[model samples]
Target: MNSKTKDAIQIILVILSILMLLYSIIYLVNYYSENDILTHFPSNKKSEDTDLLTPNEIGDSIGGVLNPIIGITGSILTFLAFYIQYKANKEQRKFFYIGLNNEKQNRIDESNKNIDLEKKHHITNLKIFKSLVSSMLNYYISSSQNIKDFLESEEAKPLGIHLFIFKTDSSYEYFNKLDFKNIYDSIVYSFQNKNEDWENDFIKILNILNFYEKLLAEMKNTYKIHSQSKAEKLNKVGESITQEIGYVLSDNELKNFDGIVEFLEIVYNSNPDNTPVLPEDQFKGTDFERLQDEFFNKYLEKLHMRYNETANEKYKSQLDKFSFMNKKIGVEKFQTVAYTKHLREVYENNFINQTNFDKVQEFLNKINIS
Candidate 1:
């Protein structure tokens, strides 16, 4: 039974015992008085009064009946005390068990937290190790003479014309001032003529590009695994590692590589004797029109910003290096059958920025077609 119920039962029993003791005493007193058993002893001795209880007899008679009731009441009180003690012990045991359970749960929770922390630390270490390895590989590749030369070459420096459009106005100016077409034609001629030195350098560049591509793919796989496993931190680490691997090639080199690959593909596959087609014949198309609209508008906007910013001292110093006096060449002269084909292919592959494409498109659009 519950503590309250047990306590109520004990209280009722105590009340009943008290009442029973009180009733027993009353019954004894009434019986003695009614029967003349407890009458005072007479000073005059009489034979008839011999049947009455004397003072000593009256005390003995009361003791005989009262002793058993007192003993019974004492026994009930002792049982009540033991019952209360038993209930107290039971409550203590229950409290102890509850405390023990709480402690066990706390230990389990602490262990789980430690395991999770260790797992995060391990993931962090792995990310660091992978990033270091990628950096080392990038350093090794970039340190090579062939790759270094390719990156530093004037052919690699023209960000414009490589991806059908220039990313910045400075690149277009560089292209015009450097007479990039002649340099490009010379490289193409070397490939067409099968120059061994140029071919070997090309092969080395391709190999390096391939290596970076593979590394990026591996990093992407790692990212996918972490994402699927629901490890958000690990996924972010993978993304960081992939980005690090991607930076193996600089923006300029990447653009140059695209142009080189396109040039190489044409030289190796096209008819060697094929005459270069006119710009109007090669560049006109619905797709080219769309590309022009998308790229040229944004380019013009940025070009306007660049013109306005030219008053800045830092910009003016940079602009002073390139002479703006040279007569600008017609886009038709450079937009040959091969170059047009390369542009279209690059556009289709999404290698060129559509907005930056507009920059070149706007410049080309403003040129007098003659």
Candidate 2:
């Protein structure tokens, strides 16, 4: 149970305990009061008159004894609820163990599936990179190598092709990140997959690379659940995650990411002190005017629908550079920049202005200095 449920149980236990205690006290007091009123005797003789019921009243007392018994039972139930609440609060946090149980198998299966997907992504990137490199290599060979020698020096030809493929694949768009796809693409060109003897071997290597990626992501998510934000252990978990995904992280590199993660974790763990500083924290003492202009121009471009939505709120709000720019920047003086105008400034001049755009720009420029 979560904290909220535990609290509710505790409260219910307390209320029931109080209610049972009151019921017992009230029942006894009312029983005596009614006996005095109905006895048809003076108040001082009420006990005497009630007692005079003698053998009949004495033998009719089973219900009187059972009333206290039932009250005690309610008291026991109240205590049990309290006990359960305490245990839930103290022990419910053992989610780590839960994950290690049957959940482990589930995560493994999930990891395997993800690995397969990553393998496909890696394979595709590699195929494209390999095809490009091989094509370039073959062109070079045809232009310079003797046709007789090309067919004869088969190993040499593929060797050159593989090197070129490795180099060109690194420059591809989606494979730039240090991900499984990136690693697979990087190593894939080293194999002579285009040759008839090599296709199956390359396919297996692709599968292995993908498996590593999934294993890494699952471990990372698990660590995030229980790891303290400021603990260096969390960073180790993150580093492990990256390494699992095929990044060649050095011990020192892991240390660096660990330090950053620890620092960020501290901010998060501090609760009420939440927000982490922007990546632009190092901008002070730099040339302000140049930075402002660069900020302004970038802000203007951001107003365009094609520009990306920046997550950097500080940069977006503080600079005032983009204050005039709406979802589009309206150029009050597009021609004012004169002969010095870059094509970029000329294009931004025609951006439209509107109410909502102006409102967001004013406050955003005040806060974001990026």
Candidate 3:
């Protein structure tokens, strides 16, 4: 039964016991009086002898009334003692209940305190994770400025001399006359060599590797997480870092960066759940193929979203051709030539207005994916 019910029953029993005890005391007192145990001071004395009155006898009779009063007062005092004991027991029971409730409340407060502490821990972890990701991306991009310029330059285009070196082009007079192979090789060597400007970038990469090593060890040792949501955010940071690592590794100039790809793969393979949402191998690209699919996908997704509402058939056709060339070009060729050609055609045909073309071009340049 519940505590309340048990307490009520105990109280009823105590009251009943007190009433029965009082009733029994009163019954015994009446029985003793009826038996006349105090009928005479001496049991052998008779009523006739006591009938003769004297001055001393009259004084004794007056004093006898006080005897009954004293007996009644004694009985009242005995009942009062029992009532006081019952009250004391009731107070003790109340104290016990209060203590029990306080104990429960204390436990609840302790649990809430633990939850708050854990929440703070998760928040701190998320902040650190975010900082690491931003720092890594910033450092890697800064270090890759030379490679970015190479990719965006006009000389890197499909028909440019730099690309034609690998193609079966008959017009090779400029290259033979200038001995451009040694010149280009020297340029590539200088770009790959670490200068003072790249010192901080190398440090950042090392720090990123160290952080991942520690994080992996921690996850292996501990099964508990303060917050699953924060853990998921950490995974996103990992993915971003992975993409930056791929971008650096894919560059022809930076391809010789030692062990970076392997280190990233180790961390990524260790936690499959946190790996980048890229194709089978992100860094396995040829020529001007961009390994950073995240940027391209972001632009493509936005493109579809923006045009889906307008139901623009020309834009749809262009998006389809881009998709087809993406697969055909694989990792060896740049899509800029084909993509720019298609945009030019669309503009000349007035398929898209000037505002839409400007918007699309701005987005392409913003993401550096065009």
Residue-level lDDT for 99 in candidate 2: 57
Off by over 4 Å in 2: 1-23, 34-71, 74-79, 82-129, 132-370
- Writing each residue's lDDT as its tens digit, candidate 1 over 1-370 gives 7778988977987896788688777977796775555564323333564555555665676678777887788787788788778878988999999999999999999999996775565444434333333443333333232322422331332212212111111222232244334443433433454434453443443354345444434434543442343333323333442353244223342223222232222222212244433344453212222222332233333334555756554334322321121101112213333333443443334323334233333322322211
Model 1 scores what on Cα lDDT? 0.43
Q: Of models 1 and 3, which has the larger TM-score?
A: 1
Better of 1 and 2 by lDDT: 1
Arrange candidates, best TM-score first.
Answer: 1, 3, 2
**Pairs clashing in candidate 3?**
none
What is the TM-score (0 to 1) of candidate 3? 0.27
lDDT of all predictions: 0.43, 0.40, 0.42
Provide the lDDT at 285 for model 1: 19
**Residue-wise lDDT of candidate 3 within 165-261, one digit each (tens)?**
1112222222224333443333233334333343344344435444433433342233123123223433444455455546545655333333334
Runs of candidate 1 exceeding 4 Å displacement:
24-52, 123-370
